[model samples]
Target: MSTLPTSRPSTPFAVVDRDRLQANIDRVARLAADRGQALRPHAKTHKCPQIAALQLEAGASGLTVATLGEAEVFADAGCTDLLIAYPVWWDADRAGRVAQLAARVRLAVGVDSVEAVQHLASLLGTAPGRPLAAPISPPTLPELVVEVDCGHHRSGCAPQDAGAVARAGVEAGFVVRGVFAFPGHSYTPTGREEVAEQEARDLAVAADSLRGAGILEPWVSGGSTPTVEHEGHGFDEVRPGVYVMGDAQQWELGTCSPADIALTVHATVVSHAGGRLVLDAGSKALGADRAGWATGFGRLLDHPEARIELLSEHHAVAVMSEGTELPPLGTEVRVVPNHACNAVNLTDELWVEVDGRLVESWPVAARGLNA
Candidate 1:
């Protein structure tokens, strides 16, 4: 007895506006180029090779990922260069996989301690013009990047400790290429600029320390969606994610306007009661990441003032303000989730939209590759 919203692709599907996505790509690429920084956006945000190709076309120097599985996925998809931004803990079994991957593409590994560099050396054998166990070749050794603490304090060494780490890499016959850090502390609403400054200062100190230890030409890399606009001092590269598909957190932090959001969940109204409407897109469709300061789980596109107070596996409870109208059952509403990364991991493909018309689909090839 009810008609479905055919204008919408389907309930609980992620829709990416083609034009907005391209605009985001071009904007970030141009800004980085003008600022003399190489942009190597984290692929963990979109996780789609099509999107990665678009970024490459827009002049991305390389790609960054959070896990080896993601690196494998992208490498198989023809990404020639990638950086595993996380300080990976590799067991003997995973070591083989790392070697196999390094043999194929230009790979970089992040490490914060001498122990990590030692483990990496044992795995990759020796660097160029060196002797090692089993007489392994040099090109298979992945480049080692010392990850220094830049105020987020998640998984990096102190500025003073970077020299020790880089020296250890050099001793182990690994090429210590550069330094990188993630300024996740900028994710808050009020501290974007300050945390970005912290990132720049910390990185500058670490780079200087490496140079003092006789490590010349140390490349510095740092950036995040919250603090990307701030060009950190001495940073030659930036690895920013979530900018490609901004979420509610970025909007709240003033990083981007509503028009800049390229990804949205298209959900249909399934029920309504007492000024509250339920949508078919819930945690299964949208991500379950609620920032400490987030007002709700997601925001409605048309009704920006509404709040998604509760979310289940199959339903999103949207609470409207006083005297606000509710969308009728079977009506479709677009929701911008709180975290685009997690929201994207929940989907298999993104429905591409251009000028209110369905154009194509982009597969999330690296979804569920957390290992």
Candidate 2:
């Protein structure tokens, strides 16, 4: 038998099962190691330094962040190697900040357009601090990785255009280290392995293109939780973030198991009527990210068959299929969000627990670094 802590009364809070979190981290790390590739997990999922440290301790090569602000926060947390894996539009103000960061640690940014390359070359070319672009003719600043679109069609040039972008970066005084892609199309249940195969094929082509332009290794980086579905070693690094905290989406997609879910939203049963219970956690607590396939706003972790039919800022209506009884009012239930990324950004802190024992609260240090 297990005993749970009933010391306080704080509902609508995010909870982290420390054991599950560690297991998730170790699973990915071991997978990456077995494949002989580096693991630079996208930190946008957790945005917690303590968790980042856990990843580092688990032998992560570095960290992948979406924003410079996130990079700064992680850098301050002693994460030296950072990759801003987004096609960041370069301007003087942001470049200066990036240069400062470069001076402090190993920094890399994603590039897509030649104009971005030109602007980076202009501002970072042989400038005092760390240059954003560096040429083979002359050593330069931060590394540049071309973002390739692998079936996502969201960003990056075609696989054939990888060389053009790498050439532009190299000519503009940027060290074209490699190419990266996001296989977002793998989010579906049945298409994950195929998408992963397509991603590998695309990266192989992109790497050849870069190598043709004198850019080697091409660090072909890509991986989402779904695409990590089956392992094939093509990309140098895989950036899977959501695995850190499995969500309802991952569970529904069959990408993760319930035991793999590390984070859950604790919501109180505020109202009960008509065989339904309304939870205090709503859009504000869990975030409103309903994919076309999502069953509802979120799913009850304790009651996997139950669905949150409706959600408002402060209410989550729970509806169980078939004949099922709703927990009485004042009962607390845990919800796994449809999307963990957005749900985590909405919370300020996460309650840490190990083996059903309460631990401490971990602040979401980089929660709102949207810029």
Candidate 3:
């Protein structure tokens, strides 16, 4: 028989099961390795260096960050190989900062336009008064990856225009590493497989186009949590972030099951009125992201029959389904947020757990580092 931890306390916090997370990490890492591809898990999910380190230990090559600030945080935490996987605009001041960052780590910046590449080249050329030794050759500047649109019509260049973008980057004095895409449309329930297939085809086309432009394309990356499981061959790497700790959205999309949900908010029932039981956690604790298809604000683990009908800043009113008993006052309930990423950003720390034992609290160091 297994013994529960006596030190366990009831607190409203995001609890991460080490075993489940590690299992997921290992499985995905093996899947990628078997395909002769690399797994560069996106760090935007947990935004915790410890979790990122676990991914690296589980055969992940490195990490993909969405912002420069996130890259800096990870770099400072001893992450040498980092990819800022978003198209970023750089002014004179921002360029100086990026140049400084480039000197510290093996960094790759994403580009979506010729103008962005030209700006980055100008930044790399001027080392901001810090010049390398006579023959050292000013630190082989940051490598650039062109963004392909894939299926999400967001920030990427068109698949047919990939060759032009790669040529433009080359002409601007930057080494075009390859191309990347987001494929965010895969988050929907019905379109996941189709979106993943589209991502593979788009990435393949983009790679061929880049090669046609005389550019030696190396990396063809794209992925998100919902579509990662259906990923196809040909891409050099896949970056899926939310698989670390699934949320209500992923549950509804069928990317994760209830047992796979490793994180939840522990809230105490504070009030009871009419036919509803009010919990202390609301939109502030659980995120306010309600997709059109999402069932409710969040699913109550203990009371599956209860519907989180209304959510205010600090209160959640749960209406018990017909013929269901209402939870008494002071009852503790667990809730999975609609979106884990937003919920994480709203909190400063997370309560780490293992087999129902409270182990430690990890700070969200990169929570507000959106700049």
Task: Give each model's whole-structure lDDT.
Answer: 0.87, 0.86, 0.80
**Candidate 1, superposed: residue stretches over 4 Å from native:** 1-9, 127-139
| Cα lDDT tens digits for candidate 2, 290-318 | 98988888998889889999999999998
lDDT of 3 by residue, 272-328 (tens): 777688888888878898988888898776665666889988888888888787778
* Predicted structure with the largest lDDT when compared to the true one: 1
Worst 10 residues of 2 by lDDT: 131-140
Better of 1 and 2 by TM-score: 1
Look at candidate 2 and give me any clashing residue pairs: 131-141, 133-173, 133-174, 134-173, 134-174
Rank ordering of all candidates by TM-score, starting from the highest: 1, 2, 3
Better of 2 and 3 by TM-score: 2
Candidate 1 local lDDT, residue 134: 50
Quick one: ranking by lDDT, best first? 1, 2, 3
Error of 3 at 254 (Å): 0.8
Considering summed lDDT, which 10 consecutive residues are worst modelled in model 3? 127-136
Which pairs clash in the backbone of model 3? none
- The candidate with the higher TM-score, 1 or 3, is 1
Q: Output the number of the TM-score-best candidate.
A: 1
Tell me which of candidates 1 and 2 scores higher on lDDT. Answer: 1
